[model samples]
Target: MPSHHTPYAINVRGLTKSFGGRRAVDALSFTVRPGRITGFLGPNGAGKTTTLRMLLGLVRPTSGAALIGEHRYEDLPAPARTVGALLEADGFHPGRTGRDHLRTYAPALGADDRRVDEVLAQVGLDEDAARRTVRGYSLGMRQRLGIAAALLPDPPVLICDEPTNGLDPEGIRWLRGLLRERADRGHTVLVSSHLLAEMQQIVDSVVIIDKGRVVYDGDVAAVGEPTVRVRALDGARLAAALTAAGAVVEDAGDGVLRVRAAGAEQIARTALREQIVVTELVGEEHSLEELFFSLTEPGAGQAPATIQETAQ
Candidate 1:
C-alpha cells in the first residue's frame, strides 16, 4: 500500500450500522488518500453499499461518523464541490440528453457549461452523444455520462460503485485509464467491483469486506499466500517424493497437485527422483475470486459473470 498522508480525502471512524436487526457495518475505519484508487470488494450481503451511503451522509450511521476531506459531507461548504459520487450510474433521468443532465448539475456547482464540454469530451462522449437521450444510449455511453457528471466540478474525491457495470471490454479499458488519469491529477477515488480478474489491472490497493466486516486491507497483490501447481506422471509417487523432499504437497482437484512449501525447481527435482515425468509445472497467480473466497466462508464460489455479452 502507498504511504498515507494526513488530510485524507475520505475517513471513517468507528463506523457501524444495522438493518432489520442485522449489523451491516461494524466499527469500520479506514482512510482513502488522494491520487490513489482503493478498490472495495465484498460478497453480495457485505455492507459496502451501506458504508458508502454513510460516508456520503446519505444514510445515518447507527454509530460513528465519516468525513470527506476535513469536513463531514453534510458539513461541506458545497457538497457537489467537495465530493462527487456515482453510486448507481442509472440514477439519472433516462429521458434527458447527456448534455442536459450535466447542464442541470453544472450551475449548482458554481461551474460553467465549459466544464461540462471539457468533461464530456474527456470521457469520450462526443457532441452527438450529448444530443442523444440516455434511454437511447448504450450502457457504455451511460457509464461515460455518469463519469462525466462526477467530473463536472472536478471534485478532489470520487466514489463509484461498480462503475464498470454493463460496459464492454473496451469500455472497461477506457474507464480504467480515466480513473488512473483522475488519480494522477491528485483526485482520490474509491471504486467497488465484484469482478475480480480485471481489478488488478486498475486498482492500487484493496479493502475487502465479508459479512459486514473487514477481512483484509492492504496492497491488492499481497492478500493471498502463494502456491505452486504441478502435474506429472506417477502422481502418487511424485507426491511421496515431494513430502520426502520437505515440500508441502496435496491433492488438488482433477489430476493436479498443489505444492506450497517448495519452488518449482524443487518440485521438479523431487518428481524426477520418483521416476515421474513432469508435464506442467506452474506457479499460481492469485485471482481476486480465489482471494475473496479465502477471506469469506470456504466453498462459497464466485458469482459467475453472466455479463459476458457486454465483454465484447
Candidate 2:
C-alpha cells in the first residue's frame, strides 16, 4: 500500500464557468473533508462535468477557485502523487494492451513496471487479461482498467466520475468496497455518479447541484428529514384520522400512506383510537434519490448557501 504524509481535503469556493455566453457552473462552492467519501450529484447539464474538469485543471475556471490541499491542481509538485482521477474510461488507446496502457504513465509517475503489474492485479485484471488489447475489453473491464490507472500512483486524493457506469452487481460491490477501504485508510475520495441508491450506501457526505448552482451541501444523512410510512386496513379512515390528529398525511395509494409530523406512537394511538387496523409502519429518512429529485426538479426549493457543517 502507498502512503502520504499530507492528505488534504478538496475546497471549491465561488467557482464559476461560462462557455459561449452560457454559464456552465455558477458560483458553486463545497468542501470535501479528508478521510471521507463525498458524493457529487447533479442532473444533466447541471455543470458536473465542467466543474470536475476545472478541478482537474483540464479546463480553467472562468472565475473563483478549485483547490486540493490548499493548492491549485496544476501547482502540485507531482500531481500523480497528490491526486488520481478517473474522469472517463474511454481515454485508452484501443490497440494498446491493458498492461501497456498502464505502463504508458509509469515513467511520468516514476513507477516501475512491477507496480503496473501490481495495479493490474489489484483491479482484478489478471496477467492474461492485461495482455489483451484494450479494444477487446468489455465496458466493465475498461472501467476496471481506468481504476487501476488511477490507483497506480497511489495518490492521496481520488476523484471519480460515474465510475460504476458499466459495472455488474459484483463489480459495483467490489468498487464500492475498494473506495470505502481507501477512505477508511484516510484517503480522500470525491465520486460523482447517478447511482443514488449505491451512493446512499457509501458516501458520508454529499453535494448536490442543479442549474449550475449548489442546491444542497451537507452530511448525506441530513439531506432529508425523517418521515413515517404507514399502511392500514382502511386507507381512507387512517388518512382522515392521521390528518385530524395534526399529522400531515399523503395518500400514496395501494393502501399505503406517507405521514409527516407524527411518530410511531402518535400514529399507533391515532389508529387505535380510530379503530383502524395497522398493517405496517416504517420510519425512514428521505432517500438520496428522492432528495436528489426534490433538489433538482423544476420549481423545487433551492438549498441555502450553507447547508450544515458535519463533523468529519
lDDT of 2 by residue, 185-303 (tens): 89999999999999998799888899889987878765555778899889898888878888777777687788877899999998998898898999977788987887788899775
Of candidate 1, the 10-residue stretch with the lowest lDDT total is: 303-312
Q: Estimate each model's TM-score.
A: 0.75, 0.81
Give candidate 1's error at residue 77 in angstroms: 2.3
| Tens-place lDDT digits, model 1, residues 26-82 | 888777888889898888988899999987889998888778876789888777776
Residue ranges of candidate 2 with Cα displaced over 4 Å: 228-263, 266-284, 305-312
CA lDDT scores, all candidates in order: 0.79, 0.87
Give the local distance difference test score of model 1: 0.79
